[model samples]
Target: MCARIIRSLLVVCASLAVAANASAGQVQVAVAANFTAPMQAIASEFEKDTGHSVQASYGATGQFYAQISNGAPFEVFLSADDSTPAKLEKEGQSVEGSRFTYAIGKLVLWSPKEGVVDDKGAVLEKGDFKHLSIANPKAAPYGLAATQTLDKLGLSDTLKGKIVEGQNITQALQFVSTGNAELGLVALSQVYKDGQITAGSVWVVPEAMYQPIRQDALILKKGADNPAAEALVEYLKGPKAAEIIKAYGYTL
Candidate 1:
């Protein structure tokens, strides 16, 4: 009788998965640049667990913010900073009571090879390198943090001409990885993943060097009942996702 009941439960669960998949609603997500890797993992895992599909667009947090404010139909937002998500909540762009931090990002001075940048966020200060890449400060949280770090060290004025701006942190990292730029300011996660491959040398910048990169996620006003969006967001805060976040060198 017990075995029969277990078989019936499995049948019911399979039927539910099929029904949920058949009726699954589509969700559009706007993710922060720094979160690309982890978000990809989360998206894959969420789909496997819930039998749902989601579409994502990634960009600089500020750029996404501009798009959202301009009527982009994003059903979820993963912000690179706390302020923007909080502001979106205030402006009613997101569902009330559905915002929270998903990760604490780590900024780094990254190069294609080791020894390119010695200790200190001082590599750009010398201005000898051919090119230094950073995300556009006006539209990327990591870029803004890079600028703030340069300013605090009194090097912004000198490095100003050597800088190349990318639309997002991922692009900025690409500039260095492709050797178009000798070095870049980037998020730590891009350099390493648990089971994936990457190449780079990175100095994880200390938190004191800049304000925290508190990445936040939320269900948008249109995504109040989006199971995929909610599941992905909730999954990120759970044990499986937390392990992946840490493995990529984020703090939490």
Candidate 2:
């Protein structure tokens, strides 16, 4: 009698497990390169907690916008700047009420070699570096911020010849990390972890130098009815995700 009861319990547990697996869903997410680390961590946690999986693609906001406009299969977008998502909403590409600010990004001038960048960002005026990397201002918001900072300091023309443009912020940072450029203006979150910079030297650009980097998230029209998309959106706004975002040096 005891063996029969145990077997029955095992059968019921197996059924429950099968049901859970059957209901699991997957959401395709297009994420800004700068938010790559935090989003990866959050996605892992979301899957574990909710039994849904996230398939994420990282790239520049402008590039993603162009792709989405061309009918890409992405269901959700985590943009580096709020304007892109807002523009998508205006264009009817994303769900109107699904937009919200997820994080505020900070721009940083960084170099892999210690002491290459000063705290006050005077390195630009010095003009001693061979190459200074920045993302394509036309495609990356952080690139725009970098240009604005140089403009505010009246160094844009002086540094114009030294500027090397990357396709995106990740590539911009790569230029610095790989010694293709001595330094780069990139997202703080890329090099920051555990409440501090991960390596090298950095100067956090003053917020006043450029417009606020209000990163926003939105569910695209394709994801309007997707349970995984909705769940991922709510998970991003929850405390666990907020903690991870903050830990990566972003403002909630």
**TM-score, model 1 to reference:** 0.88
**Candidate 2 total steric clashes:** 0
Note the Cα lDDT for every prediction shown. 0.83, 0.94
TM-score to true structure, per model: 0.88, 0.98
**lDDT (Cα, tens digit) per residue for candidate 2, span 60-120:** 9999999999999999999989899999999999887999999999999999888888999
RMSD values for the candidates in order, in angstroms, are 3.8, 0.8
Residue 215, model 1: lDDT of 88
Provide the lowest-lDDT 10-residue window in model 1: 195-204
Candidate no. 2 TM-score: 0.98
In terms of TM-score, the best-performing candidate is 2
Model 2 poorest ten-residue lDDT run: 121-130
Measured by C-alpha RMSD in angstroms, how accurate is candidate 1? 3.8
